[model samples]
Target: MSENRQIAQEIIEAVGGKDNIVSAAHCATRLRMMVKDKEKIDLQKVENIDKVKGAFFNSGQFQIILGTGTVNRIYDEVRQLGVTGTTKAEHAKEAAKSGNAFQRAVRSFGDVFVPIIPVLVATGLFMGLRGLVMQEKILASFGLTPDHISENFILFTQVLTDTAFIFLPALIAWSTFRVFGGTSVIGLVLGLMLVSPALPNAWAVAGGDAQPIMFLGFIPVLGYQGSVLPAFIAGVIGAKLEQKIRKRVPETLDLILTPFLTLLVMIILALFVIGPVFHTVEELILAGTVAVLELPFGLSGLFIGFVHQIIVITGVHHIFNLLEIQLLEKFGSNPFNAIITCAIAAQGGAALAVGLKTKSKKLKALALPSSLSAFLGITEPAIFGVNLRYVKPFIMGLIGGAAGGFAASIFGLKATGMAITVIPGTLLYLNGQILLYLFVNLIAIGVAFALTWTFGYTENLKQQIENDSKAA
Candidate 1:
């Protein structure tokens, strides 16, 4: 039998045979299975399967890390073995049913924000490129100065770098509405209304260049350009309102009246109530975050870096999306990104150490690839497959993260983007902070590697793994 088929057959038996699997699916790097009985599955046996990096029960699904190309093939083989095939969305819905209320809420936030990250990353890269080409030294080498740069050229660059942030509310609202089961187009329209040109610009109002329009002679109103919370709240309210309207309206009028009422009610509520209220809430949140990051002597960085990966293991790391967005909106730079990158890089470093030190070829195969994955900004494989398996390496990585975070704070390093980190993260620092960014990541990797090499790995762990393999 082919290796994938053989692996699939073993996985079926390990998870209590085809009878126990209700549905099966594959994501980019893992096979997700919604099983009928968790107790019947042999978790250790599943993890021990050759070419399976790791296996974990998360969010109601048994997810097996089988790497990229391998997972889809394995999934196909699993289906051929009598397991039912399901889409990732269907699997996610099933998985979502397993988590508590808080976990579900966090997962919803993740679903909303993930689709928006790519555009922001692109915009950040554009900003970095613009900064690079606009440097006075570089401009001088080209026999040009800031004044010699054409106004039209500058305008084009601004369009590239600034458009995503300026329309951030529209993107957030659209995604939020979709996640909430509302009409996404309506949500997009509502978000656009929040930043309509008719209203005074948010930035201009903040900077005293313009004043907010007063409603009820007390409440100040302006365009919510570059805002996060207000748009999110508006999307939720609009979606819920639309659903309610759709249910009550007659079939003939439902199409017209549902959207009309949803928009009419949402627009007033958003501008008059939600906008003013949540805008304040967002500012307070931003203030608190800044305060924490600015804590004396890099204590905040040390604390955050040390615990960040631990948080990732819980699967709620998506919560940082809100904070990162707020920071980018307020400061146009994300120190949170710099701090978190250290934590991420440290995971890879620790994994690299384990890969280098282990005697077993199987471990060497898993650790090296997982470590490379972490360096490129995806750490799940490294964290779950390697570092967490050996507790000491994970702790060593945390220490390394703290060291790098401390360095980041001291240097005041910040990124021009969110989402992308570690190696691809270099793009964010291209605006002139590249050297400092490299130093921070290097420190994180170096410290984690050194600590894990010196103290984390041991012959006992290798012997234990080899024994397990032999038993299997």
Candidate 2:
């Protein structure tokens, strides 16, 4: 590892040393660099660096992925270079100017949310499995769901699900603060305010019913619980305001008045303007989801399955929790259950394919259990270790997932309960379509497995790895 670091250092030195580096940031796995000259970067030497997991240059950024902790360590080293580059605001401006729908949408989402995928997945797995146990009556014998709807299992599951979303704004606020170079503590305060139970009623009611409170003379302080947009937008505005304020305000007064005044104004604007605007946007998205799910099961399934991969990639899949819980609350059945199960299973299938394909004994060993974990409806292992390690596997998982989703839709399979495990997930479709759902699921998994094997297990894979080894 030390030797690899030295090699990495040498490569960095070759790439215009500290002068060429414009700015640096890191996600969960990758060290993202904005450089003065991409041409001066030595890709081969960097690849040779020990502990370097992967390298890619895209989106006008040079990325060096070092897996877990190494990314942070490397980020510190890059920061020491004291280079400058375009800020996130500038990046957003460029994206806006491009005006390409898909690219713009993807870039907007990735910028705000992609960095937190690992945390979301970890939290999601806990909630998913907790749902499975309750739905399956696995703990019923032990009084788990003894009261049916009011069971401990249900209560516990709700807490888990709620925690992920309830704190979402805080999470987003923290990330946005970092991106905008603001005091994270201020972001925390703003996030807390949004989620705070002590605030005045911020929800609107119908007809003669109660409505949200208006702040000051005109602005409405809309409730933004379990959301990201409100805090994120506020953080952006606050960051810009903070820079201006910090420059003008004396250092002694800055500590006292700057944050206080910033928070006061940002909160007012967020409540009246930003929060309500995004709330309406979110409602439209929910309406769109409803409209799509009302389509023929086949089409609905296709849409859900296709979006599942996109959602997973964005790490906003948990945003679906509110929808699912609402389905159970109002209709007693979820329309999007099949999409979730199929996506997870697809990930496992891809892992199995990679395991069979890889020449590395260690990777093969890891893939075996990882695939099984995914098959059992736990996909983290497979996703991080196998599918993501090799790009083909992730693509295969998506293909397989889409197929499974299509089949589920065509069959109109509805799960009777919420569960993460494959067998337990079957209960959700118990409205006499059990056989159809099972058949479709088998087809989805089989197709995914076959495709992954064919494409990932080919001699080409071995040759590619061998070539990589030789180059190393």
Candidate 3:
């Protein structure tokens, strides 16, 4: 009777009823279905479903773009229809056959990181606010100096802004453990131990202001503040090790011994080998990322800006959080955020252009909200729900993003945080570069809009949507 249920019912029928489905999973914006036979699917009907944006078969799955909140409801309804065929374990086993090694790895990375995006988004917003509040000129305007501001007040704000990054390893560790079927608490505790007060802060060690706590007089050990790869590797090893140990440990003592042995073994590995090896690899990555950002003629920004959304689509963009953290640690700024913001804005602009151009009420309805979602720093709706469906708009957005990225690099524009973008991103530039931030976003939007308006979205597509709506 309800709209989402009705839509889900239609989708279930179009996918050849429950019998054809092998497994189904929903991401933030898409309903990923593994059907026994692709020939059973009604591709056009799926595309024409009222709120559906697009549909395609890829990686041995029939994936339909249902868009954010909408996907969850439809997913629930389909599950309620008893269409399921595989358990989580079975699905994982089957999924291993769906893609090449690289694709599988990217999907696994997404599985590990996507759930924590909200926390990262919140952290970026807090970082932006801190940048604004700590601006000397702004503070002076309010009859306050850096010294005049209460140290306690500053510390409170710092806690709000810095807690996430300071303990990022814990969050990642917990999530990774959950994904990999390990006990989350042990993972969390192990992460905390990596950044314990007993060790020097990673940033301080990098700055040469603090000495590493030497291990065995040959190896150096320090806290892993603002580190990703180490925590990620540690979590994987911890999870696998725990599962193996669980099988060997006695059932009676399992409760006591499993956790103890898991922690003991994991901690030793994390501190001694995994932590040092991954930390070194992370440093090389950081150095390479910085070198690319500093490349001449803004080539780095142009290329990254154009491809950033594609990276996000694959879900490996979380890896950049490490790069951003390192950049902020070393230089106190994040140019990557500024460049990525332009990419996001371009997608928003493209969707908005489609909203304005489309004659069909259904197209207009879908396009507008998708555009707004993109501007709010969530682009799944715009990218999956609108732009990619139309095709040309997505390409136009990339061009716009490249232009904006070029301008940002030319001016050396930077942000104080990561994750947040577009309107909320304004807070990031509030320290002294708000105008430049606005200018870059405006340029991205303008270029994307102009291009999309000129060449994206054919009249045939508009008429087709109108016809589909009428039939429904």
Candidate 4:
């Protein structure tokens, strides 16, 4: 049998045969499944399977790390073995059913923002590149002064760096509408109206360059460029309103009247109510986040970095998406990314130490790749497959993360981006902060490596793995 086919067969038996698997799916690096009986599965046997990096139950799904390309192949083989296959979306819906209301709400936030992350990451990279090129020292090396740069070039660069944020509400609204089952085009239009040119620009109003339009000589109104809460709230409300209108409108006029009434009512409410109200709430949230991050002697960073991964284990880390977005909208840079990258790097470092120290070939095989994945900014494999499996290493990683976070606050390190971290994260720091970013990561990795090497690994763990390997 082919290697993937053989692995697939073993996985089926390990998970209590085909009868136990209700549905199966695959993400980039893991095979996800909903099983009928978790108690019937042989967890150790599944972990011992060759080429299976690790397996864990998370968010009501059994996830097996089989690496990137290998997972696709193995999933196909699993499908051929008579197990039902589902799309990742369908699998996520199933998983969502198991979480509490808060967890489901957090997951909904993730659903809304996940599609928007790539553009933000790209915009950040553009900002970093623009910063790099605009540097006087670098420009001097290239025999070009800031004054020598063309106005047209600057405008073009601004288009790249600023457009995503300028229309951030539209993206958020569009995504939120999609998530909440609304007409996405209507959401986009409503979002655009929030930042319509007829209204005073929000940044201009903040800068005292323009005044907000007063409705009834009382309510202040302005464009919501670079806003979050207002757009999100508007999207949710607009979606629900559209759904209700669709049901009430006659079938003959449904297409025209539903959209017309939805947009008309939404625009009025969004500008007059949601925008004026939620914008203030969002500003308060931003102020509060800044206060926490600016705490004395890096205390907040230390606390956050230490506990961040622990939160990841509970699967609620997506809540940070909103905070990160708020920071980016207000500050134009993300300090949170710099602090969190340290936490992510520490996990990789701890996993690396475990991989090197362990005599068990099976563990070494799992740990090394998992650590690499962590360094590349995806920590699930390292956290679930390696560090967390060995409790000591995970703790050491937390300490390392705290130390790095402390350094980050002391140095005032910030990134141009979010969603990417560790090695690939270096791109976000290219605007003259690269050296400090590297140092912070080194502190995280070095401390974790040293601590794990000294105290985390044990002969008993190696012996246990070897026995598990033999049993499999």
TM-score for all models, in order of appearance? 0.97, 0.62, 0.88, 0.96
Candidate 3 lDDT over residue span 403-458, tens digit each = 89988888898887766889988877877788998898889999999999988777
| Number of backbone collisions per candidate | 0, 9, 0, 0
Mark the regions of model 3 whose C-alpha exceeds 4 Å error after superposition.
1-5, 23-29, 57-61, 85-97, 457-472
What digit string (tens of lDDT, one per residue) describes model 4 on residues 1-472? 8988999999999999999999999998899999989998898889888888779987789999888899999999999999999999889888888768998888888888999999999999998898889889999999999999999999999999889999999999999899888989999999999888999999999999999999899999999999988999999999999999999999999989999999999999999999999998988988998999999998977988899899998889998988998888788899999999999999999999999998878888889988899899988888888888768899999999999988998899989878889889898888899999999999999999999998887777777667876777
- A best-first ranking of the candidates according to their TM-score comes to 1, 4, 3, 2
Task: Give one digit per residue, the lDDT tens place, for model 1 in 438-457.
Answer: 99999999999999999888
Candidate 2 collision pairs: 4-50, 22-84, 414-428, 414-429, 415-428, 415-429, 416-427, 416-428, 416-429
Candidate 1: give the clashing pairs. Answer: none
Candidate models: Cα lDDT each:
0.91, 0.64, 0.83, 0.90
Question: 365, model 1: CA deviation in Å?
Answer: 0.5
TM-score of 1: 0.97
